[model samples]
Each structure stands twice: as structure tokens, then as C-alpha cells.
Target: MVPGIYRPRAVDRTLDRYRRSFSAIAIEGAKGVGKTATARQRAATVFKLDEPEALAIVQADHRRVLDARPPVLVDEWQRHPPIWDAIRNADDDGAAPGTFLLTGSADPRDAPAHTGAGRIARVRLRPLSLAERLDAPPTVSLAGLLAGDRPALDGDSDVDLERYVDEILLGGFPGLRRYEGQTHRAQLGSYLDLVVEKDFPQLGQRVRNPDALRRWMTAYAAATATTASFEKIRRATTSNDGDEPARTTVIPYRDALRRLYVLDPVPAWRPAAGSLGELGDAEKHHLVDPALAARLVRATKGRLLDGASSGPAIPRDGTQLGALFESLVTLSVRAYVSAAEAAEPEVRHLRTHRGEHEVDLIVEREDGDVLLIEVKLTAVPDDRDVAHLNWLAGRLGDQVIDRVIVTTGRAAYRRPDGVAVVPAALLGP
Candidate 1:
């Protein structure tokens, strides 16, 4: 129950389940999400390739790094890309299950020596979910809902809008969570600064204009939880001097940020069921952690409470708090879904071409069945709130295994119409 002590992550279950059956597993996520700590838990021998001495040894010969005992942890394996092929070759030479555990903050700029298809399975470690942050035992299960069992939803959380805002500003990054007020904001600023400065160059994309990159990132942060087009985002980043970076410059900027795992945009869902027609192709923008977005825009608790909008004056539905709340819900739901499904189901957003309707998050199973979710910042949702979910249910019928409205409400329960209402805190893996 220590504040910063290792709270078990939802992804731990997935790691445990797969580690015993796979020779190698790669854990990927944005920096500061605790990838190293999580991988260290399961590793017998760890080579932190980020450290100069450790990286030097590996650079001299990857075999020295790979010759360790079973369950050897290669922290930041992407630092020395050859370790991937070495691990793959070891797997080919009959490496035992769980022999190598690799943690990567970013994908290698160049492809690894081996593709690591069947040899190494990949798992993502996202920011801490609400359940993990609260250290609360989950009362409602995503797996149960996905099973089409109509499981009873019942639980209550003391977390309210104010506390949710605090979480959003404080962020779910383990290291940054301990600070508060200006200190918390400062740490988040530093984290983003690192991403813009060090993380990008390390990934082989030297940011020539750090200020311009920061402006673009701030603009993207402003677009969180909305399906804003890249053109609008580009416009938002236009400088006071009446200049905007060209498409060629913007492309590498976006690519570098994504490679660093900073921009975690939710792709628009394309249902195999063609009945859902003319879906929008725009992706919903989300920073890896909402706190980063809040910090980039200098959003404070008072500013959020007073309903002050942050960041570029981009058009978006609802207030900044609401979009952040939705981002929080999306983050937690994705974490839980990843833990529950083990394979990390396709988590995406839904929107029509002409701005007709939108679903907050769509979780699709491999079989093409989908779980529909709508996020509401309000404590209680009325019929009007779930209208889109109801519309989707009517359109997709039985294909929607279940519909849910994730809210900031206190209780988790189901409506008579079968749509489950879950408080963000009460719902988990």
C-alpha cells in the first residue's frame, strides 16, 4: 500500500501467461511507463543496455549479452539492435521458453537483424490503469463482458471529477506520480522535453528545430480524444511568424514521435460488417499519457475546475476536462482489454464520414465481434447520453457482444436495456 511501491500492473497477467510458453517476449511502450521494472520482475539476469558499460559490452559482441541464463532480461534491446537477431538465432537453436525477455522504449530505427516473427512475441505496457493506480480490486471484469455472459455489474468508487482531474494532471507514469502541484507539472514538462530532445535523437531522427517540434506536439495534445484531421493539427502548430512546417517536415516529426511511443492515437475502427457505412478514417489523437497533454497545454486543477480550455484553440466537443476524462477511460479500458484478451484486441474509435455519430472506443475481438463503449464525463448518464451506443446496437445487432458507458459516476450497474454503466475506477481487467 505504499504510494510508489510496485503495484501489480494488469499486463503482469499477460506476461505471466505468455512467458511460460514463449522463448522470447518484447515489452514495448512509451518511456516512463515502467517497462524496465515490469520486465525486471520476471527476469533472472538483466542486461540494461541503456547503461554505457552494458551497451558497450553488447556492441562489442551480442553473444556475450545473449549467453546469460534463461529468463535473461535485455533492457532496451533496441539500443543494440543486433541482440534481437541473436535472440532469434538462439530461439532457432532451441532456446527454452521464456529464455529472453526484451524491453524496448522505441522500435529500432532500422529493422532488427531478424523480424522476430514466431521467435519473439510482443506485449505492450501502457500507463497504469485506474484500478492499478488506486490499488483497488476490480469488481467488474472486461473478460466476462466479452464472453457475452451479461455479468452483473456492481461496485462503487469514491473517485469523483476533481480526483479524476488530479490523476489526469499528475499522470500515470510511475516516476512522475509522486509529485504534486507545480512539482508534478514540472516533472511532466521535463518528461515531454526528454521526448522532444533525447528520445528522438536516440531513435535516429535529430530534431533540428526543437521548438517547432514542441509546437507540433502541443497542437497534437490539444487534439486529444477528438478525430481531428492532420491538416487542422498542422494549422494549429503554425508559428506566430505566419509559417507552418511543410508536409515533408511534419511527416518525419510524426513518425519520430510515434516511433518513440509518444503519440498513442486510436485508429478508426473498420467493421467487417459492411452495414456500418462510410466510416471516417481519421484517428483519435491521444498522447501516451493524458497528463502529458494537460501539461503541454499548461492545464492546472484550478483551470480545469473553472472550465478554462487549454492548448491551441482547436475545435473539440466538450471541455478539456471531459476530453481528458475520456482519455483516462480510454487508457484504462485499453490496459484492461490488453490484460484480459492477452493478444491486445484492436482498440479504436468510431465516426461517420459526415460527422453524424461517434463511439468513444470500440474493442474488436479476432472473430470480428465487437464490444462498444461510450465515455461520459458526467457522474450519471441519461438516455440522451447512450443514444449513440443504442444506435450502434440497433445497427450491429448481435454483433455487438455488449455495450458499455464508462462514466465518472460512483456506481457500476447495468440499465434495463442491457447497456452496462461502469465508473472508471470500479471497472478493470
Candidate 2:
């Protein structure tokens, strides 16, 4: 078992759900995102397939080895695809409740001839949120805010804007948490190398030129936090070659990144009564970690936070920071919703036909209740920031249950129209 550390409350919630349902749980995420550590911390007994001896033992007598340790935690189960069938068989015989907890950095689709449907309850684990990094002052809960509880804000301190930017640039991989200065940059570069050379090939993807993929990834990093059309990405990447890869190829590459738990594309959402044509199908691209975006910018560690003040000099038309801020907000909402066991909400970008208004995120609940969220990086809240959210509430009327604007500002307040303006720093799991 892994040594004791700060147990992620979110994983605890997932484990509880698995126990209640007698379901096999699969934790998927990027390399170095703490999957093994989190699983080991919770597992009764762990069998690590990465170790050669364990691999030999599992291949020699798969079922017997698993049965010996019922309720086993299999780390990197994707390494031996046949073990999945063994797990399914064990589950069928009712060998034990919560008999298996599987962890893998790769997706099941990438696994060699494995059927994981009946045996696994999948969970996608991303990097730590800004609140989880112990970077800024902590945020309050959305559940508390929705329940009409107003927590006291202890006013902002001497915020280390530079350090915060550095953290954002380095990302939330647990492996890069403690390094400082040039060492951090070196480690990040090494990480990118590993993702391209080692991780992608292991997932059964045949990349003729990893260099081209890396270039495309860099381009994506530059365009992070914007509504990116796949066609635009294809055009950019295919310029050198007369024959361009199809949208299908681009999607799998993106999915490979997602399965690694690094890339997340926020899709557009339309009201049930609204026409899908009116709402664009384009997805706003976001890296799972904002720091990855920062690396694409090639910005020095401290420049990310100075984005607004730095004016139009920065890339992506001065919207890079705002996009990262929006990505952060999206991640926070995803984390909160997942932890609360709320029905999986569909996250969408809201835009109108007239192009007069736009809202960053509209989380539509299973019960037809909508939670509208807007993201801003400014230290002071402005009415202009939430105009679309208000417009959405007015348009949807009774269909809207909660209206929230997550901002980088220090205070939390409610608008006269009942929109909750909150500090992004205060949002936590």
C-alpha cells in the first residue's frame, strides 16, 4: 500500500459508489496524475502489473492469483488484456463484492481485445484543481451556496501572482509538484517526450511522425480556451502534406490525449426547446491542466497572471488567460458535480443567432434544471461579465435553478437578478 497522504475526498466518494453497487471501478487518467497512488491508498490488496514478477504470476495463473486476493486492486491492468476476461468471470461467479478496482492510464478501446463493459465502473481523474493545489485562498462549496449559506470571505492576502502563474504553467501532475526554477521546465519537457514516445505507442496508436503530433499538440495549446473547429486544426496540421488526415484521425488523436486524461473539449449545449442549428456544434478546447496551455505559449513562469495587464501582446488576441480561467471554471464545476453524485450534467457553450450574447458554460442537469456559469479572471466583478447569464435566466425563466459567475475576484455576491458572483479561488470539492 502507498504511504499515507492527503486522501482525495473525490476518490472516496467514487469508492463509496462502487461498494454500494458491487461494481468494478476503473480509474483512468494521464501518466503521473496520481492514479496508482490514489488506488493503492484505498485498496485492500494491490497487484501491480508493471512489476515483472507480478506480470509473470498473473500470466501463469490469472484466476487463481485474483481469487487469492479477492477485492484486489489491479494497477495498470491494461498491460495484460486477458486479465479483463478473468475479472468478468470472477464477477459472474460472485467471487466477492467490490472484488476489483482497476487502474490504467490508457482507455479500454486501446486495450488489446478486452471486453470491460460489465465489469468496470469507469471514472476519469484529471489533475488537481487550483483550489486543490494550496495555491490561493480556498473557495466555498456550490452546494452550500445553492442552499443559501453565505460563508465569510476572509479577504484576499498578498497573493503570489507569479508563483500562481508558475504553478499554472507547470500543471497539476503530482510528479512535478515540488520542483522549482529551471528543474521544473526540464521536467515538463521530459514529460512531453514521454507522452509522445512511450505513452502513445503503448496505447496501440501508430504515429508515423510523433514530431507532427507534438506540433499539433503545441498548436492546440496555443488555441486553448477557445472554440476550436476541428477543420481549423486539420488545416493547420496538414499544411505541409497534400493529403490531409480525415476528421476521424484528428478525433482519435484528440481522444488519445483525452484518454490520457490531458485534453478536454467543452461541447456546446442547447435548450431542449431550442434548435440545435442555432447553437453551434463546435467545442471549446481546454487542456486538463492550464499549465499545459501555458507551456504552449512559451511564456516565462510568471507571465500567465499578468495576462490582462500585459494587453494585446499575448497570443490568441488577449484571450489566452481568460480561456485558461474559463477552463479552470469548467474543471471546478466538473469536479464539484462528480463529487456530489449529481446526475451527469451536459456542459455546453451558449450562443445566440443574433451573435449578441454568449455564456461560457451552461450545465444542464438531468431533471431539466440548468446551472449557468460564467468565468472571469478580473479581481473585480462587473455587470458586463454576467450579461449573458442574466439573459439566459430571463430566456429560460423557471427552467433555471442556479445562476453563477465564477471570477478571480475576492468577494462573492448575488446580483439583483439572483445570479451568484463567486470567486474562483473559493470553489472546492
* Residue 175, candidate 1: C-alpha displacement in angstroms: 1.1
Candidate 1: where are CA atoms >4 Å away? 1-4
lDDT of 1 by residue, 1-429 (tens): 355467789998888888778899999999889998898888889999889999999899877756877689999888888888888888899988988999999987786756788879889888988888885677888888888888888988888888898888877898777787778777888888888878888888878788889999999999999988888999999999988988788889999888888899999998876888898999999999898899888888898888889889889988988899999888998898878754567898899998788999999887888899999888889998999999988999888899999988899998988889998888888
TM-score, one value per model = 0.97, 0.86
What are the lDDT figures for the candidates, one per model? 0.87, 0.68
Model 2, residue 371: distance off in Å is: 0.9
Q: What are the runs in model 2 whose C-alpha is more than 4 Å off?
A: 1-4, 110-119, 135-139, 145-164, 237-252, 275-277, 305-318, 353-355
Cα lDDT tens digits, model 2, 1-429, are: 123465363546766776666647787777777788777765777888889998888888886556655567888888887887787776787756677888887765646465657566777777766666664545566555433244443344333445445556667777687776678777877887888888888777777767667756776776676665666666556534455566766777787888776787787777778633376666778877776666654656345555542211223434566676677667666666556565445677776654566778777767777777887776666788778888778888777777788866666667676677777766765
Give the per-residue Cα lDDT of candidate 1 at 26.
94
